[model samples]
Target: MNSSAFRPRLLAAAVSLCFAAPAIHAEEADVAQAGQALASISVTGARFDAEPSLAPVGAIIISADEIRRAGANDVNAAIRKVGGVYGRQSLDGSPDFGLDLRGFGTNSSQNLVIVLDGVRLSENELSNAVLSTIPIDTVERIEITRGGASVLYGGGATGGVINIVTRRPQANSRSASMFVEGGQFNAGEVRLSGAQAWDNFAADATLGTQRTDNYRDNNEFKQTHFSGGAQWFASQFDRVGFRYEGARQEMQFAGALKEAQFTAYPRQTLTPNDYGSLDSDRLTVFGQRRLYGHDIAADLSYRKKTVESTYFYDGVPSPATYDSKQWQFSPRVRKLGAIKGMVNELVAGVDLTKWERTTASGFSAADAEQKSKALYLRDELRFDPAHEGRISAGVRREIFDKDYADPLTFAAYDAKQALNAWELQASYMPVANVTVFGKLGQSFRVATSEEDSYTPLFNKPLAAQQSHDAELGLSYASATQKITARLFRHNLTNEIFFDPTANFGWGANTNLDPSRRQGFELDAEHRINAAWAVNAHYQHVQAKFRDGVNDGKEMVLVPKNTLSARVAWTGASQTADVGVQWTDKQRYGADFANDCAGQMPSYTTLDARYARTFGQWEWAVSGQNLADKNYFSQAFGCKAGIYPSNGRQLKLSARYSF
Candidate 1:
């Protein structure tokens, strides 16, 4: 059967079930109680998460309470324990790290979609959306979708999507918090945040600064961030919000070492004079209104970012600068409630974004511009009472245009591409405590400027990548325990990737023939009692080249196995947690021939945290790599060996809240 007919048939079956709902009677009170328990631990960043058993797309949520309990210093630290997430650490011990998802390798800047408060943060092409710009002290919660989301989020969501939600003021309330921390490696941090609200207005702000003299030679870093937001309730049915953020940071780079050097002196830096800096600013305004019995929302945002870097390769001076600016607008409408005696929820939206970047190297200058527009519609239906079962379908059409030009050289290049994406999802609860779900979707990802035109002499735009995704999952939840298991696969064509083996020392963009990634994930949380709990997550994935010269060969840098486990205990005044993480060895790059000579070794780590709360004051202490195990967190080609992860380090912090 054609896939196009699958969606219509699914919709018809759901409607028929709804019309025959009277024949089936469920325990209403029991259903409501089960729903309450599900809601307490459900993922809600997506439109389907509003109801029970409707989110079948492998979603994970990390709350602020969890973050604080983990003694997380940044976003990367808080998300490391999540399944299917691999955070590669640097030698400096900075939390501004890179991540790999769904066996997508180590370069996630072009494969992941990151957002903050409904505003696109990594929509530009200059650099990764530095998560450091958003202070963790101000975050309320984070939502992560582990699979492709091109139908919900516009583009470059081939790997997944991460949405960060910030704290908002409570009605008729005011609060403040302050934190100070100091640790090994001469690290120091300070943060302050406050929120206030009146009858119909609320405002909040956060300020933070941190500096560290890293463990490696010539690796020192400093950063400062400011974020604020205000919201006004014009009436009971309308509200508006404005948010602003700015950040500045500077750091010295310690280039990678050779194999022998890394083994003999792990903390040595190959390039001690290299340095980099960043400055960024963003502003967003959004509004929501209840009109015509529907919910309407709109947002507008502007962002400007600049980065400069100087590196010495083989004792040769090389300096470069990048400046990028972007504007985005999104408007959406949602309809909820009964329609034709069936519970129906519908959503429609449009998104528009424009971005421009300029790069200067020595005396040569180049400019690139990109624009995207999309229209999308989604519908959800619930057949049984209390939304025991749900079916959701969505479709999106997107248009993109990109251009690059050099004024002095009179060189120009342009490309235009259009893509269509759709997904079908269904979830059913055979029993009050168990849910079974399935999803099928098509996803698209366009190439970025860096991936297409930023090479030494490349000016042609790469072909857009496409993926066919399918997933099946089972979830079980009780009042005190939860368990989830998922099986997923992604078939990709013309997958764009960085070719480090091309053009000598400079990397080039290339499209691979075809590839496939299939994986299984298991996650569980159990509360032994009121004072003891345990959580564990595991993922096993196999990534291989399906066609071309590398057919049947495993993809480099994509690990086959990963695991995370944690145990915690809480008392009246104190809480303690112990966690362990492990990763399996995989092929390392440098040679595209899939040679076993470049394989990276596997390693595991142990960590612990303890916190005490008394009255309005709190104290916490944390230790990472508690076993002092030596491991390689990241490794490049054969020429650039591996970077050693941090050794045993301890830190203490103090916080006050009122």
Candidate 2:
């Protein structure tokens, strides 16, 4: 089908399913109840437990069961199914996948914020988050809050925020699980997890290791992760906890391929000896108390990471090491009361963080540091007792102090910046099972250490990036069906990004001219029957430079359209699922001039899984790229800089409960 006809047909099918929901047999009322329960689940990523219908923005929650149904092996694999989001493999050959949201293209990682159990996983560098270090088995749920969220997350939230909530021990219970898996291309993994709860104390721990000789030559990868936590409950509303996590990873890079090279030898490496290793450790202490109708909580954490890599420069071997450390503390309080005879909720919080990194090479050493502090407050008012009408407003002020020094070059630079963010949101339920919501906000981002070090202007700091964001949406939820459609727009100034054409082709990180990104998204799901279910999502985005040298030019690597769908079946002791994803063509990475000879080609892939439970154990088989399609979704130049997507692969796994 043609692109124009494809969208309408898919959308009509989804609408049909939603409209047909009312005809379902009365016996399926239980299914509707279950759907309603899921919709009411609280979203912790918003700083407080708030339901999607009660919030002004769009939010999607992926439960652990849904993750398993998708047969995702990692966090990146799981979240790629979300609307308006895309994932690409790391160029460095590490397991850290880059995720793009709302057409941010090459700067996606710097625009999106990632949080793990309330701890910011997004770093102050131009690098992606190490999602592979998070064991899938330990995750309870994943919450995706779309649009600018700087008012609560501080910074780097122009695209949104993703929070991964882990499983916790339940009171008076003890449980354990073990998982082992083996797959194509000499891949293997093992994981062990246990949790215990007694009296007022609870504890949980997980250990996992994985090794794989991926589909390409010289692309071996290995990683080990360990995490544990303990909590003491003084009362039903008070608690203290401690958490520790550590990870070690090593990998070999299979350098990028040119057109001819990729066509002839897609799985061969150009740089055979390139390799890297990473080690990270983190510790956190947190506590919460409730008194006098007020809830207070605090979190303190420290983290350290070391990375070493060796790659050929000018056909000569060169090696470097990076050491980084960070400290963070956050405290917040929430209260419920009455305002103008209406129900009201107020939340206030403070954030403080310090980070520093040192890079050592054969020539000289360089150092960089960033310190930030922020304060924010938000208030929500409900006009009715049923919460059918509500409005909220929030504001945040943050300050950053940055410094960079290079001994060899004798270059030292320091900068200070202050940024502000505010948002006004409203939601109304005019009829049963229907909601209309709208929000307007402002967000900002600061230059990373790497970006600052390569500024085109000698010692002059780059301006901070800023954006004006707005969204309007409507949603309908019922026992057997759920549908949501939204329109969003972002107008940005001084967008922090790398431009290869800058400084006479020397390529430096710099601020770009005015740009805009606007899109429409549609998401729908229907329970066909007691054992069958189907869901699909479609997104259309227009991203371009609004003014300047590249006026009206399409942004590089930002696809205009994307779609995904899935069907699942469940029986007495067996479950099966199938899914497909499609992406439209777009300009190559760094091709901001829109002068590339050819755009990256559009592609589609299929995935499927089947599992059966037997007594206290379960077994499953899964396959990715089932059709063995050949395509490349990422490229950095007009014709070269290609990274091929993996071909057909299959895996078998088993899990046991103890």
Candidate 3:
């Protein structure tokens, strides 16, 4: 069926399912209880402790077991299996994969927000988040909130929000684990982790090292990671903790290949001598306390990073170095009370951050700095005792002061921007195990330091990107099954992006014409029996220029259709899983005119894993791209910029507990 016809049918099916719940032969009391239980499951995506059902949009929560069953090597690998999300290999040949949501394509990194334990991981520059630095073993759960979330997360959250909660030491417990793995492409890894807890003190630490010679020449990578934390429980309702994390990474860049070169020799590298190295460290101190029916929390963190790279351009080696530092502090309070005989919740917070970067190149040096402050408030009201009917509203105001200086040219410029975001949401349960939710919000993004420095008008600051976001959805959850269907749209103005054809083909960062992204997403999971389970996700999105020269033209790299499915089995002490994903054809990157010679081809991939547990030891084998399918999900130019995807890969791993 055509897209126009399919959308309505799918929507109808979702609504019909909500009404048909009563017809199912199940205990109404049990279903109602299950529904309530699901509604009360706490989530941190809202920057406060709240139930997932109270959120304006659909959310996906991935547990640690799911990540393990996927046999993912990193956080990005695990996130790709989720619906309405796509992951692309990093251009720098690092493990930091690019995750795209809502078809933002080339600008996906700038549109999405990533939070780790209540700290923002998304950088203020053009680079993607360093997902590789986070060890998968440390992850307790991942919460994904779909659609704009600028009200609580500040800027650069126009696409969605992903919160990664790490594991913590448990009271009166002591455990240690060691893991070793070897895989194709000369990949190998070793990790050791341990935790100890006493009556009032807890401590945990992790150490890891990895090395890989990737599929392409000049793509060797080596990394080492270390993290440790200590906590002191002052009382039953108060605690303070401190954490330190550090990493060192070295990698070689293979560079992009042309269409012809990719077909002839996909593994060959034109820039064989290009190489880069990075050193990063972060320290965080956090505290939480409960007093007078209110919960208060705060976090302070400092991070330092240094990177150096050498690129051989036309056989002339050019070396550069970058140094950056960031400091952030956030404090918040949440209270639950009764208002007019109904339950009410209020959350208020403040965020303060300062960041600076210095870049030194062969011939010049530059410095950039940004200071930001924000205050936000969110409140929710529940109409019924079970929280079956609820309404929430939130607003945030943020101010940014940015400065740039070119030391060699004695040039300096400063700019300041103030942005605001607001959202209103409501959810109602019309029947047992069924809920309908809707939301309308405003989100905005300011120009990054790099984007401002390279504007078309010389040092002039670009306009803040803004979007009007809205979504509606229905969800049904029971003991054995869960399903959700959502329809969302974002109408944007002054979207910030690089336009290669702008400024007389000089190529510069600028605001684009009006654009819109509208889509439908469906996610479902079922437990067929004790030993069998299945899940599936489907998304259909239309991202296009709504006006100007590229009117009605599809955005580059934005696919219209994507689907994924997985089957899992467990019996005795053995577990097995298989999954498949398919992506539809899309316009090549930089093909804003939608007149490229050919679209990026559609492709499907298969992955599988099998594992067995033997007392305190576990062993597993996993494979990705089992079919050896060759496809590229990222390109910078029409038919020219190509990054070849990896071929078939296999790995074996063993873990021992003590």
- Score candidate 1 by TM-score against the native: 0.90
Per-residue lDDT of 1-658 in model 3, one digit per residue for the tens?
Answer: 2322222222222111111000123354543453344345356635654565454356788888888887876788778874336777676666676788888887788899999888888867777788787878888888888888998899989889988888755689998899999999999999999889998899999899999888889989999999899999875447899999899988887777778888898888877887778888999999888776566889999999888877675789877777889999999887655554555667889999999988788744879899999999988777775538988899999999999998786667898999999999888888898989998999999887767876788778899999999999999999999999999999999999877666665556789999999999888999999999999988899999999999999888888998999998988988998999899999877677877789988999999999999999989999989999888887766775677777888999998989
Which parts of model 2 have CA positions greater than 4 angstroms off?
A: 1-41, 50-56, 82-84, 234-236, 385-387
Clashing pairs in 2: 32-479
Query: What residue runs in model 3 are displaced by over 4 Å at the alpha carbon?
Result: 1-42, 50-57, 82-84, 234-237, 409-411
For candidate 2, lDDT tens digit of each residue in 1-658?
Answer: 2222222222212111110001122233443442343344345734754445344356777889888887887888888853325776666554556787788987788899998877888878777887887878888888787789999897889888988888755679998899999999899999998899898999989899999888788888898999899999876448889999999888777766777787897888877887778888989998878766566888899989888877665579777788889899999887655544455567899999999988787753879899999999888766764547878899999999999999886768989999999999888878888888898999999988777876789767789999999999999988999898989999999998877677666567789999999998888889999999998878898999999999999998788998889898999998998999899998877578888788888999899999999998989999989998888766766666677778888999998988
lDDT of each: 0.73, 0.79, 0.80
Model 1 spans with C-alpha error above 4 angstroms: 1-57, 82-84, 90-93, 234-237, 314-316, 407-411, 454-457, 503-507, 639-641
* lDDT, model 1: 0.73
| Position 89, candidate 1: lDDT | 68
TM-score of each: 0.90, 0.92, 0.92
By descending lDDT, how would the candidates be arranged? 3, 2, 1
Kindly list the per-residue Cα lDDT of model 1 for residues 620-652, writing each as its tens digit.
999889888877756656534466677788889
- By TM-score, how accurate is candidate 2? 0.92
